[model samples]
Target: MRPTFHLKTLVVAVAAFSVASIASAAGLDRSGQDITTFLQDGLYAEAVYTYIDADVTGNDNAYIGGDNNAYIQGNKTGDVAESYDFFRYGVKADINDTFSVGILYDEPFGAAASYSGDNNFVARGDLDATINAASDGALPNYAQAEGQFDALQQAVADGATLTPQQQAQFQALGSALAIAQAEQATKGEGTNVEVRSESITAILGMKLGENKNFQVYGGPVAQRVRADVKLRGIAYGPATGYTSHISPDQDYGWLAGMSYSKPEIALKAALTYRSEIDHKMQIAEIYPVAEALGINPVQSNTMEMSTPKSVNIDFQTGINPTTIATAKVRWVPWSDFEIVPPLYNEVSKGSYGPDGLALVGYDDDQWQVELGMAKRLTPALALSGTVGWDSGAGDPTTSLGPIDGYYSAGLGAKYNVTENWAVSAGGKYLWFGDAKGQLPTKKIVGDFQDNDGYILGVKLSYQAQQNFN
Candidate 1:
């Protein structure tokens, strides 16, 4: 007799691709929070690894400038974002018939990008376009090295002999000129960036009644966030030399959910809610060398970063002897989430603010929906397919994250290696939505359209039966 699972493994394959991530969703939501670690039966441990390749493209334009002219005519900013590699693991243990415990680890949110290359928007010395311009097209007063030289000549002529005081003043002026010129020399060289976060959760489950049809679970969640950023281009203005690094911080949240399942028919329905995690980050800010001209050069800044609140509903049931149907709906309050350090607010010119506008925050929440089905073709093999849609956090978003939303499709295959082990492979493709990257002046920086993302993943699971019955 062939060892057979038939339709028993349908839900497992479908659940793997039910998540939306990469450049597909809103905010920094990278994993889609698909908690499959605790969805299996018996004493189980599982590991999954994923790789994502994605990019965004569009024309650069300012939303606020008069005539609404384009900022970058032909060159696109995000050709291919930094590739992302992620890993997740979970283990579950059942202690008797009424109590079970599980622990899970995953990346909840992240972002990575680089804006370097030849383009009119990011050429070296490009910042001087605005910095060197005179008021109303008139020659600026002592704007260049030539002007500084002329001023130094005038000072020498006025001095009767070389006094020590006058010599000291001349040295200071010379130093200031050197600093000013060097500041703009490599303005476009270091424009890379990265932001990352991870989470760990411990869960407690209790069985209600005797049949074990109802299970209630709750857990405490902990997450860590770290980021480094550097900005340039004419859009940044005096903020062009702005660079920031956020020291990592760990914070806590909570999750609660309930599930009703009938194993005989391979039916399961779960609703889970995860609370928002808040972190107060300590930051080190460095500025355009000119900022050194200020009274204080190095400053410490603190910003409050709240992850987001989310709800997920998942359902799966055997459609036939060999097939199972699965679906999911997820909601996240992305509009309420933001990252704005106090220093960014103090330096950000125009309408950008910590209270009203943001360094990077959405104008609305996000909603994601997906539908899929899985079928067992042979006792050792199963196949699954899924389609999904995400209503992005907002439209006309910030350059930091300029995606409106996406439509996605996926495929997966699972092969049972033995009675206690299985290996699964899966891949998903996303068709990203459109958005206009904005400046504080409400100018459109980039019109990102026709973007895409590709993700590949694999999973391994082991089940060990320990019956104390």
Candidate 2:
């Protein structure tokens, strides 16, 4: 009974704080591929709910100036992110002692941010100044109009009094100035952005040899993604007043892994690899204001959106009769993830992206490490604690995801209510590393410092055994 009950206690402790442990680990990574579904001993099912909140404070500055965007001007706060909830569900069945199969549902990547307050955190740069720059790029006759207006002004300054001919010329210059003012009206404000991704994975496991001590597993995975970004203040000025939408699209990938275990010592190690999922999605760009500038107002095009590939190495061993030590190292190649819209590439070729780069991308890969321990406190209760660290991909991070790195700690507990039912809960707090907001130009927009985040979660697990004759 003691050995049989230990499985339930372990499931609760592992699944309790799973969401809290990896809510903000890397680029758009909400879950760190914990693979808790494989921890079940037999037919098992689990459900989890998590609530995440983060406080990221930074200031916005005048875009016309060359100073950092985090300068404390008049704005009080730029708390663009909001609190949200997430859920996970899974089921696994052991087909005899040597073979097992399982399925898992989780949200791997997501983003949600909405700027609030009277000030324009949604668009921090100078609107008037950006129009001046945009006019030069989008307006064909802008310089000619300016030169004509200048010559008329010089004539008025030289003459003592205004003649009829000179007055008519002045009227013509006024008309040209009106045209410039109209051009300025075409610019608009950027408001908010929301992006989401969900995944479902099916897996199968087989015993390695006659001893049935080693296992190998592989599976097929599918995911869906949707995103909408309103550019009230485009970092690239000429591309402002644009909204980019990627309707929910499905993509496919695969995962494979092998595990080794020693039952007598309760030691196990597993290595897993997840392939990148590529999406060829149709993008709709709404540029109501862009059309006024003689650019395409409505555009429909297919784009290649690919998520990063990752590898996970997980290990655990019983340190003592009542304690277990566990560790994990995860690597993600985030430098491969890129979002390049058609119109953005067209305008940013010479202006924002000197090397013809993406609208948003990272410069380096990402890595995360976690060390933790679990202990049995009572016959039916177990407790766990963990500490983790993430090496930020780079400094001067994207405004879309401003965190540079993080140091985090978590605590969890599991309680068995009956022979077949168990409940668990946990929470994690992270001290986020600060970095400057960078644009496509690779210039610092502002500095974000001293921000923090937290996640709270609860989970339930049920075990069902079936008899076969």
Candidate 3:
């Protein structure tokens, strides 16, 4: 004998546990890029707020010069992971028994981190010290030729003629001196990075099958992205004193998915794919080393960036008349994503050949999975619990966010304010994996271990069903 599920009660079971998973998973994933609102059996709307705080601490590599054998753990890095928060809103309506429309908004991908204290990540010493450290004692050579270099520079300014050889020497000396001065000016500052983005998706769905049990949906997505980065101190060596600002840019992409549901046993499953968005954005960069490579140290230009494509699978089934089980799986090809600023790429051509390198990149894709259960304890109250894991982009990742992945457990509860309104709250604790931080040059620069963090979220939602038969 099969136990029949009351549609109203089953709706509560399916929606009760959604708050517990997908926050701070991996590779800049936030809000899980969820679309569950459109899968509900009735008109549904929700607003959610989530906050996350992480304690990421480790040791900076003392050997900033990049010799592996001579490398030693340096000073404590303090906590680099900053607290982050965001909001999400979703609304869905069934236009008819065979059609539906929905809109979803969320902050999908982002990062925030700051480094302080006596570490390689922070600049140290006075002007002279900074100059000497940055120039590898080459400051003395410049000091020796200060008189000649100055005379040649002033002569050029005054339209004086010189031999081509003299002109070459003069330019080389000036660029070296300028880079040292730039380094000295930034002395005593710490490293920091911040990235933010927002997305909105509009979707339309049409039902299929004899019982109208299956649905296919497609949508257009609008996304906005911006970021700022500053790399200071000896930890970055020649690349120290580098900064980039990516102005906000909006672009469009697409989303497609299919879902199946059976109200009798409260069974539902959805598989969704989101296409990558390409953004052409204004960028400003200040690279101290650029001058030394015969390129201007300051530049403002346009760069093209692609966020990354992803896929998600969400499933839920009834365990009993009052209990439901759920599972979520997500994949992102982070390895295919990277940021390469123009001036930085041009400067790198002197050493890495024509291919150059990206300012940020990952070596592997990310995979995340979470399993959970929800139980309706009363007609108006429900509780949920979940356990999750994420395969980080990779170990030896960029130092900006030096974490590999995480193991997490979460708890949530929902209370119905009325038959159609409800409030839910959830919290998750994460145990982060150990990682060795590296520079874009493939130099191991830091070691982070035994780190952890937490996430908290609250949501208010409304749902109303209509009889279509």
Candidate 4:
């Protein structure tokens, strides 16, 4: 007779490895958009917190001010990747043998990075010299202009009547001086970028087939997104001193999936697909150099954007009464994603043609895979390990997060606090792949090599299985 394996015996083993360890990836992927909580047996609820710290350093190309084609080694860029953290919450319950519902919330996409130190990414230059150069010697230096403006202001205060032509000249000088002063204050500042988004999904699942072995689920997803970006210093060449802010916007999308399960051996598999979400956002942009091209330097507009769609496959099966194996695969077409702020796109049109260029974009799609194993050592204790790999969007990617992909190893443990409550902790070490950082114009600006990072996460969960006869 064959040995009978009980699904309940390995519940702890599977839960131990359920904590996600992926906090960063290509094209702003975060939280992994996981929906596994809904697949758990019985009533399930979990809250997970994850933190990511990355050490990403490199050298800016030595062509900041000279020939753009030069690729000489330059100053060290320091650690530009900042530390980030977020939270995820999920709750699922069965209404009956044939119906179920779940609600999940997570930060689905984001990025944070800042550049500093004595690098080309940091702004540096004499205010007067920059003004003279940008104007091709047509505009007076800051000192000269300040002196004339001060004299005119004193004369006006002394009740001296001025001609309309003189008044116009004085107003122009004042505006020019103000712009120069503002730009001067930015000296020594570095480039920085931060993007954040949140998503909540409500799902309804229906059981099908004999013994209810197959299930299908669909849901409506609500997502909110916002971002801020700054490009300073010569590393950006003609694009320096550019800034943009995307106000928070909320949009809706949809998700659909199907799953199959064999309770006897604890076998389960799910394939999920998420639709793209479109957002109409209010964006404000400031291009310090726009005046040189005869266009207004400040602009505010309502722009349209769409986040990419994705697909994920999750699989797990019992290896024995005490162990379970798991595998996950994910795909995202990042190359289709782009952020083209109005002012930035308009400025680039002078060089990149009518369509212009995107302020942020990718060159390829992304694929991620992971395999893992979990074992229940005691009735209340379980341990798990996983190995993962990510195929980044492409090399010569954005300078903000200059990594191609990564290889990772993770370890996790879970302790049952009681029959209905448990806590899980996991950590993953990542070895990042080397990549060349490029601007939107396809100009290489930095080379990052041998970079690495780590992810840490904790999950608090509750589960209560219901038995039906």
Candidate 5:
């Protein structure tokens, strides 16, 4: 029979060329042709996405009334956080059509890990025995002025050993070491868990008109911040505790944009701006059980924080030839954020007195609004959807953390095959709104609430061909 049907048609063409070479080495047709050129170029290449999607959700609340016999008698609750996701993969090349360059390994920023340990607005144990009997009635006049400056520094190291009642007790221990160094320069240095931050950003884009759709670039942006501060709670028996582990501050900012197109009704518009990079962090203020129970010797502070400044405006139109629609807006001023740290101006100029001032001073700000739509059920299939709205900034300062205010929804899909491969998938959902605050001082008590989160993303791509002539 015709040589057994030509060896079964060469074993079905070598099993369809081994499943198209394992779907082009598993990058699924270059992430489905970069999600069909990012939904037909209407997603305004969110800062040039070779493939990136991020997510995070967080919330917090607190309430305590002034001295109604020190209120906050339980029933205060908050917390439901826990949602963060990130996935990135980028690449751009054209090195010759008036120049081009790209590299955007994403994960721009992330953080969302709940907290509410055994609720009931924590702060019980008889309120630490009534704040240790009001801090031992305000530490016996600052420990009798630190025992008259330790008996005049042990009588000047035992020199001038004469006595007229120890020179009136060394002038009352130099008037109690000048009032305990002026009340330790205004009571500075006290922390016990509060709001914190986590971050990540990578950018690289370069291009200039004449066929690359106008461009300007910038690079080098790195950040990693973590803070858990808490002050005033163990009253007079166990308070000092502030854990911060920071060391990831690499700055150098830049980013500029411009785009306009009209491939015959496949209109497009873009505007990008990313600038604001400042991180002089170097914190390692640990107190791991007060340094494994030997107490004090874990200090490292170097602060100067900044991560705010973003502006994006994208617009796209092409309601035919495969459908497309997009509109985006973003503006972040994060209330001109501030986290001074260098002893926040020497604890507000009193050198660490007045309890070392600065319990947390934030001025935050934010804004966002996006809408998207895409469809192309042919030459390789495609689909997309997006919705966003985030607005709410600063007003909750109990260490000013928890940052609530959001409402986002997303979904994406793509699957190109030839013309340089492609494949992609995305997901997002954030709806957090409900945060109250009041705890900058007044001896901590309780009231805080927050909840909502979900996000998932993926992408892949590949393009090769450009032998300029």
Candidate 6:
């Protein structure tokens, strides 16, 4: 049977495009004013989609016996993926040649689904034997064979002084029960974690210069960031309880920028930057049955994370009156990024101890480039195409989250319906790179493969000649 696209898939694609559009606009000079003016003056609205995929691999060594003595070997592996879509509409009115005001609404950020299933990492049947042996060897007060024999004797004695044959059967059952209990007390749950974030931003712009070549602007950037984290197939040890839910966090920030152009050379360039925003998240630490399910919620804590800063440069020059070429380069400093929550820190410092803390080391920095050309097919139509590349953040990636880089190609067109009205549409395809990360425990690793995405966008605008006395 042929596969059909779902409505959610379409929405995710559209949202992803919107994010790219916002990033594109945010990186533009003069607070993205030029693009806003171009759109608003034409009385238009825009819709966009953005998508991303990432893979992670890692190994973690389980330390049983209450953070000391006992040790058991285990492994884990998985992938993280997502898609986002956004739609926006706005209008611009010129107060004069030197100024204009506009308002826009768009979904700035959002995330879709993720997966981390258990395969080899879960030692189901033999887990009891392995954990029992490790705990008995490590714990100071543990008595190996003697403790097992004593428990067996007690069970036999309680069975109304069992017959010889029944006594043997009871003894064997007792030993198995003892071992199961020992194992249950020593095994540490392995980690198979995933997380995602989505948000939005809005702003206004102002222009200054005879030819509108220079401009400055700023506005409130409202954002909503949501994260879903899961740690599955865990083995519970004594002294530790686990929780499953981590609530989503939301906050707001602001943006500003400037631009310059030399019309004679048909050359233009601009610089834009966004400030970092913080989130204090409230998360559920542990559940009542966590020990049985191998899930633990760290103690109460605040999750502190922020989106990185970006810089973009755009250049356009006329090849002739009928054709123009444009290019863009963007820089995102992901290396400075960090996730520190009170609960995470406590778990690192307390429970699993130092080894647990090491998993927190992560730094990512990325870059992107784009090139495009627009040709005037006629007085009312213009056609354009662009290709871009986004570099992946860093090596030995983390399962904490995945936002790998990609290769993208896009096509676009602008149609002029009248001297003062115009409409534009564009679509892009992205090929994502694979990603992997190492688990703190031994023999465990996660892998994500074959990541790709797509985007579509539409924009409309109108221009009104201003009157001055």
| TM-score quality measure for candidate 6 | 0.64
For candidate 6, lDDT tens digit of each residue in 1-469? 4233322111111111122332321111111212333222222344333333323333333543334223244454444333344455555555666655555554433333344344223323343443353353332333443465566577656875667875654444343343344333323433333343443445455767666778675666655555443333333222122233447777777667676655554445666676776767765554223222233433555566675556656666556555656677767665666545444444445335663443333455667777777667766777777788777665445444333566778777777677656667777777666554333332123444465666666665554446654
Model 3, range 1-469, lDDT digits (tens) per residue? 9998776775665666666578754677777898998888788999988899999999987652326434578889999999999998999999989999999999999999999888878766344444444444555444645566788978989999989999876765655565556656687788999999999999999999999899999999999999999988766766778999999999999999999999898899999999999999999999987876668889999999999999999999888888899999999999999999988888777668997878889999999999999989899988999999999999889998899989999999899999999999999999999988888888888999999999998889999986777
Per-residue error at 327 for model 5, in Å? 4.4
lDDT of each: 0.69, 0.69, 0.85, 0.86, 0.43, 0.47
Candidate 2 vs candidate 5: which has greater lDDT? 2
Using TM-score as the measure, which candidate wins? 3
* Candidates ranked by TM-score: 3, 4, 1, 2, 6, 5
Give the distance in Å from residue 91's predicted Cα in candidate 6 to where it truly belongs.
4.2
**What RMSD does model 4 have?**
6.2
- Per-residue accuracy of model 5 over 1-469 as CA lDDT, tens digit each: 1111221111111111101110000000111111112212211122223222212222222222224124333432344233333344445555555445554444344333233443322233333232223333333444554565576667678885637886665554443333233223223333234233333333334445556555454445453445444332222122223335556656555556655655455555767776776777776654322322234436677877666667766666666556666766666665565454453233233323554444444445566665777666665666677777666554343322344455767767666565445555556566655444434343433333444454555445554456566
By TM-score, how accurate is candidate 4? 0.88
Give the distance in Å from residue 242's predicted Cα in candidate 1 to where it truly belongs.
0.8
Lowest summed lDDT across 10 adjacent residues in model 6 is found at 25-34
- TM-score for candidate 5, residues paired by index: 0.30
TM-score of each: 0.84, 0.82, 0.91, 0.88, 0.30, 0.64
Off by over 4 Å in 5: 1-255, 269-271, 277-315, 320-324, 327-338, 341-369, 372-386, 389-401, 408-447, 450-469
Query: Could you tell me the TM-score of candidate 3?
Result: 0.91
> Which whole-number lDDT from 0 to 100 does residue 408 have in model 2?
90
lDDT, residue 210, candidate 3? 92
Candidate 2 segments exceeding 4 Å error:
1-19, 63-76, 118-120, 123-190, 234-236, 288-294, 350-355, 464-469
Could you give candidate 4's per-residue lDDT for residues 1-469 as a string of tens digits?
Answer: 5555688788887877767655547989987899999999899999998888989999988643324345768889999999999999999999999999999999999999999888877877556744443333556477877787788888899999878987876765665554455456578889999999999999999999979999999999999999999987666755677889999999999999999999888899999999999999999998876675678989999878899999999999988888899998999999999998999899878768999999899999999999999999999999999999999999989998899999999999999999989999999999998988888988888999999999889999999987664
Candidate 1 residue spans exceeding 4 A from truth = 1-24, 62-74, 78-80, 120-123, 132-185, 289-297, 349-357, 465-468
Of the pair 1 and 3, which is ahead by TM-score? 3
The 10-residue segment of model 3 with minimum total lDDT is 125-134
Q: Which residue pairs in candidate 4 collide?
A: none
lDDT of 2 by residue, 1-469 (tens): 2242244334434444354556654677777766756755568888888888888777544444444443444343467666777788899888887778989888888777665443433444443434343343233355555676678778778875667987665554444344344334433343567778888989899977765678899899999988887655434344445578988999999999998876555567889999999998888886544433346667888888898889988887766666778888889888788888776666444434554556678877888888888787885788888899988777877766777878999998878788778888888888888876676657555566788888898888887665443
TM-score of 2: 0.82
Task: Give the better candidate number (5 or 6) by TM-score.
Answer: 6
